[model samples]
Target: METYGVWYHEVTRMKGREWMRRLTLAQKPTPLEPLTRLGELLRIDLWVKRDDLTGDMVTGGNKIRKLEYLLADALDKGADTIITTGGPQSNHAKTTAALTKRLGLHPVLLLSGKPPEETTANLLINKLVGAEVHYFFPRHPREMDDALLRLAEEMKAKGRKPYIIPVGGSNGIGTLGYIDAYQEMDQQRQEKQLSFDFEFVTAGSGGTFAGIYMGHQAVQASSKLIGVSPWLPSQEIKERIIDCIKDARTLSTDSVPLSGEPALEDLSIYDQYIGSGYAKPTPEGMKALQIMASEESILLDHVYTAKTMAGLMDLVEKGVIARGSSVLFWHTGGAPGLFALQERWSEWGGG
Candidate 1:
């Protein structure tokens, strides 16, 4: 079978066509290094991929990589306004606003979570960047999609060009961003002569997981990609991610080609750290935030990244990996949302 990823050359050329066209992006090959103290604590040689430093103006996260392609497409289509929806404290929405403002595109953000009492960091930033905020009562996660579609139709009726980016940028096109990260790691492994036993990440919308899964399959990377699910059961997350991978594989191949039923055995999804539900931060996640910051001076958010880090720590403690086995933890930033719960953080001694 032909390889299932874009070359850096192709990745650049593809950037200026279709949705990827007109998408010039900032540099974001974040440093991957060993977390010596935390690794010692867990008895594993743990590493961290610092996506938290990936973008400018606190738009830090794995989402910037995807936005590079997404916004390019929007501009290519001559979109005047960018409309995206998410929770009140969504990292994705906040980053979308920041990037849109930086590129001179109008931003319309729809928020669908609890209304904050004061100006939380994300809310403050959204207003500072002049992105319109629309609120909705906290409801089932599925409601956000309905809201997004309805708003798109309304914008269409008004004759305004709107580009709707799915929550967390989970679609096939955006998922390609993560696949590019895999390519970066492949090059890093060669340059550093690192034998990465496994790659770890917080699995939120499954786009990141799907990218790593498809990239590994295409490049035959030796590292195993393990997804720590912040929400949803392992089985359900795997099914959703598998479907995304299938679609992405088709996109990469330019058509649906012969395949062996989405070979995803190397993908492991663990759901041990999700305490209450989506958006509900856990005590363990809080502790992880404290521990990582104090030990490595690395900050982790409570919602997804810290929870996934907590799971990685647990896996290390239980010897699920191994002593001295190299593992990379992908930090999918949500730190701005940290201020949204500063009171909780102070109470829990997380400052």
Candidate 2:
């Protein structure tokens, strides 16, 4: 197996291809480290893929991986401004704002929900990065897409080239980022002679899970890909992932190949961790965050990673994952969100 660097070079060498459209953003091959004490507690040989360290201090996260491709496509289309949608404390919105600023492109965010009386965490970062933010309470999340399209049209009428990035940037282009990531992980596995029976990640917009799943299929990896949903129902996530996989197949025939369409069974999204609803802190998730912080010195956010950890722990406790099994947890990065939910943290025994 070729190293990630080698594989990346080969893929990018296809200059004219759509899948080749990507900007260099993330620090590649984010360290895959052993979780010794945590593993012992679960009775599993656990490892973590540290995607939290993928970029700049404030902007680092799995979102940057998608932005590398999404933003590159924006630039390629001669877009001077980017229009995207997300929740107020969205990591994707914050990363898009930061990266767009870094590349000298304007960012306009149409955030869902009412504007907060006070801004902090990702919202504060978005402001500091100088993104133009608009807030609305959408009747449905899909309505945000329409809102973004209308905004893009208005921008175009003003003679500005505006690029619209979907919520979570889960499109075919963004999914390519994780396809590359899967190859990178495979290379790492081969280099270290590591084998994991299961690979886990938090699934929100579904693009990340789709990309990873496609990548796993592309590499014929043996591990089962598990997605712990912190938002959306399992069926909804499955549909979105299936759509993304289809889009990814159309985008990257050379890398991922045009295999048959992935079935619903191809996805494994667990919605049990989405307690109370999106972005709301759950007791199990809070406990999971405490466990990670206390045991591994790792911080997980209430909305994503902590819930994912909670799900993983639940599986272990239920004996679904056998003792001594090898597991790989993909840390998608949301530590910054901790500050956004400080009040909730206080309730979790932090003050």
Candidate 3:
């Protein structure tokens, strides 16, 4: 327990639960279902954490889960406006706008991607929710963060209480959402007597992975977390996750000791899956989407989770992971993007 940090006991038990309650958060635990066909294809026992079916704005992605906690914190702090950023067709931005609108708070989206001529599906959805859209043509990643922070500061100067959710809501409180998910999965495993050797997910901002990592430590689950990085280098993702775990531990109570240095599992990220960069889908990703939908009757978006699936398949084929080991693919969800890729699927006999 010595390594659990100073606030460990208070932070882990009632304080963590209390913090969650204060946020008016929705605890929608997603189902952990087995992917029978996918398992057969990979020659492994495969399961999917169906976060895509997360009960929200009509079966939304993993962002909705994080948003439940983050927006709750915003409301708890009496935030009048919610601010966030992502790509033009960002699922996070769209979901934030929807949830903020539902809570009667103004949402401002700062997008760092190509401006749409007719607007993407997510853009139209954001518009419906009355989110003010701001676009910045940033050729670099640092510029995007800078633009978002600068805009938030300007809002503060104007006396607006702006709650800025980081891109994908990948922060401490945001990460707690996945910790809750880990517990949910743990329960499912117990009921079914399932033993997973590892779980796979696509890490965008690293909070999800960090949360799972910490949650595993907390629950004493042996399942290894493998993150397929959609963006950011491996070292950067590892460092960010470490920092998040440190902060989470700092906020936790002393009775829970995460004795080891916060670290990511022995993970592999096939950077090739990121075709042109973030937001652009790869050829293999498109193929994977078609295969998954056709074989498994599941839809995957081009950007985040689909690419992760493609990578997972590749790893399975290459024997990077043992073939027969039980694996869970976190279906992070962004199927709205499939609408934008109609042309790509047209050749594949899209309905």
How do the predictions measure up, each by TM-score? 0.89, 0.93, 0.88
**What is the Å distance of residue 157 in model 1 from its true position?**
2.2
Provide C-alpha RMSD values for all models, in order.
5.4, 4.4, 6.3
Q: Quick one: ranking by lDDT, best first? A: 2, 1, 3
User: RMSD in angstroms, candidate 2?
Assistant: 4.4
Q: Write model 3 residue lDDT over 164-275, tens digit each, in one string.
A: 8988888777777777777788898889899888788887877788778777777787777778777777777777777666665654432334766754454444455676
Total backbone collisions, model 2: 0
Candidate 1, residues 234-259, lDDT tens digits: the string is 77677778766766664553222335
| The candidate that achieves the highest lDDT relative to the unseen native structure | 2
Deviation from truth (RMSD, Å), model 1: 5.4
Task: Flag the better candidate by lDDT, 1 or 2.
Answer: 2
Clashing pairs in 2: none
Residue pairs clashing, model 3: 7-252, 8-252, 8-253, 8-254, 9-253, 9-254, 10-253, 11-253, 12-253, 23-72
Clashing pairs in 1: 15-20, 16-21, 17-21, 19-73
lDDT by residue (1-351, candidate 2, tens digit) is: 121122122224253443466667888879899999999999999999989889685746899889878877787688999999988898898888887887788999999888898899999999898999998877655787799999999999999999999989998888888888888888998898999999999889989998898889878888988999988998888898888888877766446643588777768889998987888888898888888889999888888999999999999999888999999999999788788777666775454
Model 3 backbone overlap count: 10
